[model samples]
Target: MIAKEFTNYIFKNNIIRFGEFRLKSGRLSPYFFNFGAFNSASKLSSLGEFYASTIIEKKIDFDVIFGPAYKGIPIALSTALSLNKKDYPDVPFSFNRKEIKQYGEGGQIIGSKIKGKRVLAVDDVLTSGKTIRNTKEIIESEGGILYAFLVALDREEKGLNTELSALEEAARECNVKIYSVANISNIIEYLNENYDKNHKFNKSVREYIEIHGSKK
Candidate 1:
């Protein structure tokens, strides 16, 4: 019920599209999660609140919020803001630059100092976990511990070389549990048990998972 609201909201807002989609892995996906559709200020704030609620619900602990360059920048800021509003006041957020700054008052990091802090890295999704692993290296290199990583979704597809999903590999490699608001499995279950059975969405998802998804 609570999770159904999330899937429905995503579909209603066009955040997740149901159709043929070509992923970077060169696989044709039945559905796609598009964070870019969350383009409005209100939507962004809501997204932040969702991520904060997931973090709180999971009871994941950390001292600082960090995001990798580019896509993760807003996620880190929004999560920090929402966490601040929801009993986590003074939680500092930071993001890395694409290129290290070598000039006056400059470095790679752009926000709260990370040394000695337990950092929670936030991002949109877990595709390969390569970016997350690199982020972990960056944080640990500076004396910060990467306590956990949170993504908006986990596709539940297997890793390139193993039956474990990308999230599983990332968790294993980073030695930290990864959390997500709603994964593809949740969507599939919600659709099958609820919503209109006549619609093709649930059936399509079932086929996709059967062909490509791995055990979560």
Candidate 2:
């Protein structure tokens, strides 16, 4: 899948970049996607629309959209708003707080009744799956049934062995299906088709990905 809209958005906004950088994972990465740049209302709205489109395309059925907190909060809120705009209204969206508060909403979950609902965890990326697992525990504590996870990108690299991606592990542990709008492979393919390998960062990214991205 080309994911033209998503790719174009990333490209135009400089949200995803080609570079020599160290990731939080301590790996030298060739490309980086900083979803944090979607700070303005317009950008947030646009991002939500893309996410909503992906949800619709994937035919995801769930009662609640749960963002994992911080980053996930805007993603869930924007996606919910976008879905609302498209007239695909579904009530109940919530997100976790980094620090579990003892007051106000109480505990970690905020924004909706989590119990007894089929929840979809939403986030920008699935790196180690730790965040999702923590969110799942929070929701499940309230009797929420987390049956699916949706993300923007899947790196498609191994966590421990090359046999499993973090998304795959999250799905297995959550006992739900998982999906993403795009993956590392998709980005690689897109770059290969759009620009020459001799281009500044293109060849290096392709080579790095080919070495570390596959499910070895």
Candidate 3:
């Protein structure tokens, strides 16, 4: 379900934009995953189900599902909702605010509290991982233990001054495990097999990977 529907949604909605695009890391990337593309309720429901299934399949043992501020908020919430529908039901979910509320119910983390609990951090992608690293720190400060991080996809590009991709390096740095639904290599293989040899999209993707891919 995730394989076909997810891919179809991405391509159909042009969420997977391809071209010479500049990443936040200042490296030129051939493709970018725009999570903002999941604009509809149906799209988010599909995404929520995908995330839920991935967590269940990976068997990520944890107590809390934490999402970082802004973009990560919905993913964490929706995932919790989806998980509630499945075997792992009523999982506590949480997210941080970029700016803490100054009044009434003032706090950073919302939804599930993260004290003396093992957390599974969720996000869309692992780019630089600065935000994620900060998220882990916040969790730890709040007395929660973060042992695993999950994302929708992994680009597999090198992190800052490291041979490992952002996802791998983040996992190692935080001493936690990392999981993803798909990676660049997986996407490349899928494109190569599903698309024509002369497809411009796949060609650009291959070229980009050859240039920017992490050695590891």
Candidate 4:
């Protein structure tokens, strides 16, 4: 999708917001994004297309995509399906189980061959990055080669220190890059381009970025 279309799609659907809210990471956020609200196949299909566009834009290279348990499962499936529709049918997708199922697949991972394949982990948001880190460990234990991770948003806030967030740490530890469809900076830029009081939120986001977004 084009930039205009992508931005309108997200904004029109209320995927992004500005307000006081408690985040899952326990930080007070001025905005919140919930792509999980996309419930229909059509919405999911379109969202996946955007995700594919972002991945292509970043030139992320990976043979397969792995989504962690629960939320990541559908995102990965939809992204894979979108890529498939674009004639990139060779890309395979997989997801993990929250609990080891006693029947059928019998393991934490399901769909496609994960072992030894260079995989890109997909998820909705990169908050603390703990989820992605754990997922990476699981994939590695299964012999999957983690290439990188792609998420819908990057909070751009520090994780463990005023310098780095958990996502960055994960990238450092895994020796891979972390790409996002948009980030705190992007959001601020978007707002600055479209709204009034831009400096206020921009400064706020920057403060968070400086305080919690780097690894020092």
For each candidate, the alpha-carbon lDDT, in order, equals 0.84, 0.80, 0.82, 0.77
TM-score of each: 0.92, 0.91, 0.92, 0.86
Q: List ranges where model 4 is wrong by over 4 Å.
A: 1-5, 198-216
Candidate order by lDDT, decreasing, is: 1, 3, 2, 4
Give the C-alpha lDDT of model 1: 0.84
Better of 2 and 4 by lDDT: 2
- Provide the global lDDT of candidate 3 against the true structure: 0.82
Model 1, span 15-96: residue lDDT tens: 9888999887677887889989889999889889888888887888998899898888999988888988987768898889
lDDT of 2 by residue, 140-184 (tens): 888999878888888776565546777777777778888888877
Q: Where is the poorest 10-residue window by lDDT in model 4?
A: 207-216
Q: What TM-score would you give candidate 4 relative to the actual structure?
A: 0.86
What's the C-alpha lDDT at position 55 in model 1?
84
lDDT of 4 by residue, 16-40 (tens): 8666778767887767787766878
Give the per-residue Cα lDDT of candidate 4 at 212. 56
Error of 1 at 190 (Å): 3.6
Preferred candidate (lDDT higher): 2 or 3 = 3
Which has the better TM-score: candidate 2, or candidate 4? 2
True-structure RMSD for candidate 2: 1.8
Candidate 1 lDDT at 86 equals: 88
